[model samples]
Target: MKKLLLLVGGSAGLGEALYSHYKNLDYDIVEFSRSGQQPEHVFLDMSRKETAIDTIDLQFAQLAKQPWQEIVLIINAAQIGPIGELAMSEPKQWWQNIEVNLTLPISIMGRFQTHFQAVEAPKNIAFVSSGAATSVIEGWSLYSATKAGVEHFIRVVAQEQSSKSNPITPVILNPGIMDTQMQATIRSSSEAQFSNVDWFKQAHETGQLASPATVAGNIAAVLSGKLEAGQVYDVSG
Candidate 1:
């Protein structure tokens, strides 16, 4: 029996960490991202929604031909952009953020479900979510909104699969504040652009941020076990 992991946004941060962890466990890893250079990595640019969805469709079609004991998907790619308030954010970047963080993932999920509907494998999916889904962070309107949209969409997907005997179990994983390049970008933002900039800076200075590897390990534990459909799992520092 073989196990496969279809990891989106597997180029950096928690995605990279998960890639390494699962690789060590001997799972076939098909990483999708623009930057990942692994032999199994499929180059995917989330900015181009139509092209990205096409690529994902092709990949899932190929994946459907394989026999597997388990298949897992972890969508960790996101755009933490349009950091400033809505009025001050650039239109092009704001739309790009929506494409990457919302539409693209949703499209990918739909394709995966349709393609693998008949596969009787233990299919699991975990969507990385955020506290921003529930918090109102100033100057983070676009980022916050996209996170909330994705999280709800995840629950909806789970709800749709709940009645299936071999359902594609989907869960929301909230990886709390972490020390990542994304956080670096947040810390570099001026107070005018991000009201909570100082808080991120202080977190970095005080070493309060969780390591990506640690968070990835916690997430792996959840994915490797039996998951309650539509449950929300929070991994904190």
Candidate 2:
């Protein structure tokens, strides 16, 4: 049976690249994103919890039989909004960022773990993380806070899944500064909005930013290869 590669946020950026790469490798790719282009693709609007629920419900049905040797999951979905200042940002927007980055991953991972518990094949799950998890950028209060939370959350999941007879492996990854649309947005930010705007702009201008495809390759390698506990593997290195 063909293995399944469930790609969250597969419609764009690093997600798109990973989907293409894994598809070529013959994994049964299921894309979950905001784009409702195909019936097989699960539409996701990260700002809302309902979309995540729907996607989980549908996948539960498909993988109910999870007859393949293993299922690979890559979570490349995140929100970088509520920028500028903590007090200046709207409560709804800031909360939504936390929901997307923190709550959604736990929900998805729990469902998959419960469903695949009996399966003997190891299920490797990876989160697309960033350096912001440990950074204190001036305008990224919401984004930084959420990333930090999930990084620790993954550690908790790792401990829970570490027991013998459990095939679930969780990996919290820091994919580094990639030349994605998010980087472009940072590059365009005003100095007041982002203190390091010139730094990012220079990275782009000097071709220092990593390619999305390259980072995706590093992610795919870790998720499909090994489970290094408590380590946040940075793809840049």
Candidate 3:
């Protein structure tokens, strides 16, 4: 049986880096993304919450035909920035960010938990989370709140899966400040919405940010079970 690597949001950024690395590692890869650039990738529009769950289900059903010893789910899709104070932010966009960063992954994890409950194969679920999960950044109320919410969801998943006979490993990976397009978006944020915009701008200007490829390697380690489960870990460490 082959190792199956499932990537959500692999069209670009760190997710793309992860896909490339794991594809070379010989895992049978599956991707879910909005771009849908390849025939093998399952089309999943992060903006369309209504269809996301079903798309995941359909993909899972199709992949079930494969005889696999392990399944690793790496959730790298994030709706990072309509950056601003929650009250001042555009309502619809803010809601969508929450939907992408928090609701979507949780719902998908729920499906994974139920589907694999009876399967004895080793499983690993990892989320590409951020320090924003705990750090309160001014003008980033929505982003901060959603990241924090995601970590709590991780905690719950850890607890829920701990007692299973052939338990799934869950990891919340804090990949540090990676040099992704998301960083550029943060650098371009208005001061009114993101007070620490200058910090991000400076980071990029001085080339201080970590490369996505490097962080992607660290995340791969977590998914490979090099790190302990049910805990929050920083890749830099």
For lDDT, the strongest prediction is 1
On a 0 to 1 TM-score scale, where does candidate 3 land against the true structure? 0.94
Give the per-residue lDDT digits (tens) of candidate 2, residues 8-127. 888877888888788778888888888735345887776788777667867766685768867887888988876788777688888898888878877777777777767776677888
Whole-model lDDT for model 1 versus the true structure?
Answer: 0.89
lDDT, candidate 3, 115-139, per-residue tens: 7656677888888888888887887
Per-candidate TM-score against the hidden true structure: 0.97, 0.93, 0.94
Q: In model 3, what is the error at residue 220, expressed in angstroms?
A: 1.3
Predicted structure 3: lDDT: 0.82
In order of TM-score, best first, we have 1, 3, 2
Q: Provide the lowest-lDDT 10-residue window in model 3.
A: 221-230
Instruction: For each candidate in the order shown, give its overall lDDT on alpha carbons.
Output: 0.89, 0.79, 0.82
Model 1 lDDT per residue over 98-174, tens place: 99988987888899898887899988888898889889999888888888898888888888898877789888899
Candidate 1 TM-score versus the reference: 0.97
The list of candidate 2 runs beyond 4 A from truth reads 36-39
Higher lDDT: candidate 2 or 3?
A: 3
Please tell me which predicted candidate would have the highest TM-score against the true structure: 1
For model 1, where is the 10-residue window of minimal lDDT?
Answer: 228-237
Task: Please list the Cα RMSD from the true structure of every candidate, rounded to 1 decimal place.
Answer: 1.0, 1.7, 1.5
